[model samples]
Target: MSNNINRSLIGNILKSIRVEKNIPMKKIASALKVSESTVSQIETGKNSATKEKINEICHVCGCSFDYKTDRKKMIDLVLYIYTQYSNLSTDEMNSTIEEVKSNSFISCSYVRFEYYLILYMDGIINQNNEDVQLFKRILEIGKSSFSNKELSIYYDIKALEKMYLNDSIKA
Candidate 1:
């Protein structure tokens, strides 16, 4: 973990895959010959993971790190969308929205959650009912399965949905 290595997307992706494989942090720490605290910090985005560290983590979690594949592409796409969504110009934003809307590639729940989130944001920004309905369907799929980070986004989207309906005060 270093101060310069970006966290968030990569960290969450690592954590998500590790969780999916049922690999504990202690095990990953042992595998990487690092302390559990270091692994925990890396996973929680408090610290950062270098490329070598990311490879080791993906290896330990049995996740493919090959960027040529669709899984990797989708992960990168989601990461790019998540990291750049706010800074995107209107034209770039619309392009991303169209790209996401036209595709149905979901390799994992984390991706699915993020995909729906982009749609949810697009729905809010563009007032699109189809996107909103899709977001509701995703929320109904699972709340317990999401990571804490994803859960935070879920709550924010839920609140926004309520606000959109003018029922923010209700359950």
Candidate 2:
């Protein structure tokens, strides 16, 4: 992913965590010795936070921030959602959905498509038609550029969505 994308994702995750914990922007600014607007800019992705500043924000929010680890976790979560969604409890599913929605910066187009597929399956989002159109455009533009894994995910999403929308379809 690009640095700007990472910064935005990190900022979003920080903001989500802070909001979930009921920590105000002003409090975070006070703890970090920065202006509230600085905190707001960081959270809004208008400005990138330094590593030290990110650490301070996480510390104030009583959370840990590791960009690579979190990104990996998101990838794992997306895979789990795709392959084992039926096994997830309601609370687990809802929480995972919320986390994925908050940190919506999957760099891989296929993975991002799968994320959208899962959300559509859960009825949390209604982008099936748009997704289909986007996939068609991708296929037209760069069909041979996709990896085997990417194609596999695209097919899996199509099959799953098909079965989901039409219960008469058999395996």
Candidate 3:
């Protein structure tokens, strides 16, 4: 595939996901029993993932590309909002965070954290210092919608690490 993908998006998402897991690329590559170069290639988008690679990436990153549900779609919306409202003041994000904390809204849930991260993966929001903090909040409070429901927390843990720190997460 000659489609151009933003490398920074892939790299930041991979880096954040990897960092959240407290593991290294070598470890992930080892899990796949593939060369580190191969894993690196996929993350860097030097190569596109085949079926196996997609599953592997999904396993490694805890992201779902489910076509039937709103989980992924809602997250995309959040990212879009971020892009359109990049001009949103810190007050706005903080207000949204407060609103999320009040109830189990989508924006405050672990799901939302995953969504935000997906945006991060797409390079929608970058060069910000608040990401790590938001990630941390989601990790602490966000429940396991994907994992507890699907019988997998490996991805949830990896994905929610950043969210736990992010009080901005809804659930």
Q: Which number leads on TM-score?
A: 2
User: Which 10 consecutive positions of candidate 2 have the poorest summed lDDT?
Assistant: 137-146
Query: Mind giving the per-residue lDDT tens digits that candidate 3 earns over 26-138?
Result: 88788788888987876566765555654565467555423233555554444444443346554564454344345333332224445544333223233344464555443
Which candidate order results from sorting by TM-score in descending order? 2, 1, 3
lDDT of 2 by residue, 35-108 (tens): 99999888777899888887788788776664443434444565566454556466676677767667544322
Prediction RMSDs, each to the true structure: 9.0, 11.0, 12.9
TM-score of each: 0.44, 0.49, 0.41
Candidate 2 vs candidate 3, TM-score winner: 2
* Candidate 1: RMSD to truth: 9.0
Q: Model 1, 35-64: lDDT tens per residue? A: 999998887778878778888887887654
* Candidate 3, superposed: residue stretches over 4 Å from native: 6-12, 60-76, 79-114, 117-171
Query: What C-alpha lDDT, on a 0 to 100 scale, does residue 84 get in candidate 1?
Result: 57
lDDT scores of the candidates, listed in order: 0.63, 0.58, 0.46
Model 2, 131: alpha-carbon shift in Å? Answer: 29
